[model samples]
Target: MPRRLFIPIIFLTMLSACGGTPASSPSEVASPASTESQLEALATTSLLADIAQHVAGERVHIESILPVGADPHSYQYTPQDVAKVADAKLLILFDDTSYETFLEPLLLTAGGDTEFVFAGAGVGKRADLDLGGFDPHLWLDPNNIIRCVENIREGLTHLDPTGAAVFKSNADAYVAELQSLDAWIVEQVNQIPAERRLLVTNHESLGYFAERYGFTIVGSVLESFSSGASPSAQQMAALIDQIKSSGAPAIFLDAGDNPALAQQIADEMGIRVVADLHLESLTDGAPAGTYIDLMKYNVTQIVTALK
Candidate 1:
């Protein structure tokens, strides 16, 4: 139906000739380092870690509690993750709890003093994008990520007030980048004709993307938003019919997601399955490595498949 969808790191080791002892740069000396080491922040999900890193910059190294490329919808928390939660001074999680299967276990084991930041706490979600509950994949829309940056800025400021200015500067720069990414997505999506902008995903997480980018989500392979869910035969038949009728050319599966189900559905319609779409988590260092990269990669693939 109707939809709206919608980084850089530099480390310079400065050298000072003070009896071979290096002095801190003015920028670094200005921001207090006291709290950073004393209060470490960790992002519980892979996507949160990526976005949080952009906002955090050098203020704090945001560790990922969840492994890279893991599906948060069905991720199981390890004992090491519990220890990380216990030690973390602040934990960043997406406000949309429905999308994070690891949240409950993470919280139950978290220290009482551990601060929490909902990265997309203040962003608005479209009513059309609600799948069962609100779509937890808010990061799919670049505009929503603007608000995520803001939330992260504020949360980091709270965590280490001494780094407020640093956080603001990083967040502002990243917000501008996100705006550019949004514009780029619009430009790239234009390659697809409106009639051709139909999406059939492995999960129902693309609602925000479809609404923002003027595409229709024909439906997902899983009727639910979680990849862990299994579709009933009836549900599968309905989705197959929907995709066939909608003329959706391919089934979009997230990178590293099991494509057997989507492959089965696509086989029914004689359509292709577009695997390697990175919507859930970042990859090691290429293609969906960063949030921006993930969006660009997914958009390019979707446009290519649909156009």
Candidate 2:
């Protein structure tokens, strides 16, 4: 089928999956007439906001606290950010507080009455990468994202019961898309030989992705799970040695991070620094504007660097 014709057919299938109800396209959802009646939601990061927006399906106005491409681990909250939290009827967050250090104080100050949900509540941590707690980058794996979808669906429904059916329908369609994404990722990763599936990143962000996709994480520049932590000279030296021995092709760096250290290591080691990965946040526009696009872009970058 032609691309133009295929698009509507996919949506029609989604509508059929929604029990034949005319599913409201995301853009078709009407905005609230007034601030008092608006169903406002806040997500801690852009990635979380994208996921929430899927289930919200025009029912809730979702805003992300972190700006586009900002580092979530070390983001500084402003007075205006606190106000955003206060204004939101619901706040959705990733479960790991360590990764979002600013949220603790911000929540104490302004989140007393605002209802919130943790999308990573029941997801298991990768044993090899557990620093002090579970790896909070669970969204890296589509399986974990499915759990996030469930939590988000329940949370949105709980906040606005009238939109429960819409939320469910939206989630079902999104989850199906995610399932296809997972399979696509598997086929893409298979392009790289099994022996070459070694990963070395700026931080331990890819633990869940590595575990889910059968890639071996050789080491990370920063040993900590959160990007806020600085690595000692010894740790950096040791990581360089690991890279040399493991023969990993590239050092995947989050676009939101400083990248100075990763670049330094890459320069010293004569390895490529694949700094295009959209780990902590999504892009401002096309290529990686959506969660699925972000994942596909990252996977393609990883494969191109390693394959």
| Residues 94-144 of candidate 1: C-alpha lDDT, one tens digit per residue | 774566767765556543345667776766654433345556788899999
Q: What is the lDDT of residue 145 in candidate 1?
A: 87
Worst 10 residues of 1 by lDDT: 6-15
Superposed on all Cα atoms, model 2 deviates from the true structure by an RMSD in Å of 11.6
lDDT of the candidates, in the order given: 0.77, 0.80
Candidate topping lDDT: 2
Total backbone collisions for each predicted model: 8, 0
lDDT (10s digit) by residue, model 2, range 1-307: 1111111100101112322232234543454445345587899999899998998988898899998888887888998887676555677887746667788777655543566677776777554333545466888998899988998888898789989999999999999999999999999999999989999987799989998899999888788777867889999888889999989888998876678998898998888898778988999997789899999999999999898
Model 2: residues with Cα > 4 Å off, grouped in runs: 1-38, 127-130
**Model 1 TM-score, 2 decimals:** 0.85
118, model 2: CA deviation in Å? 1.0
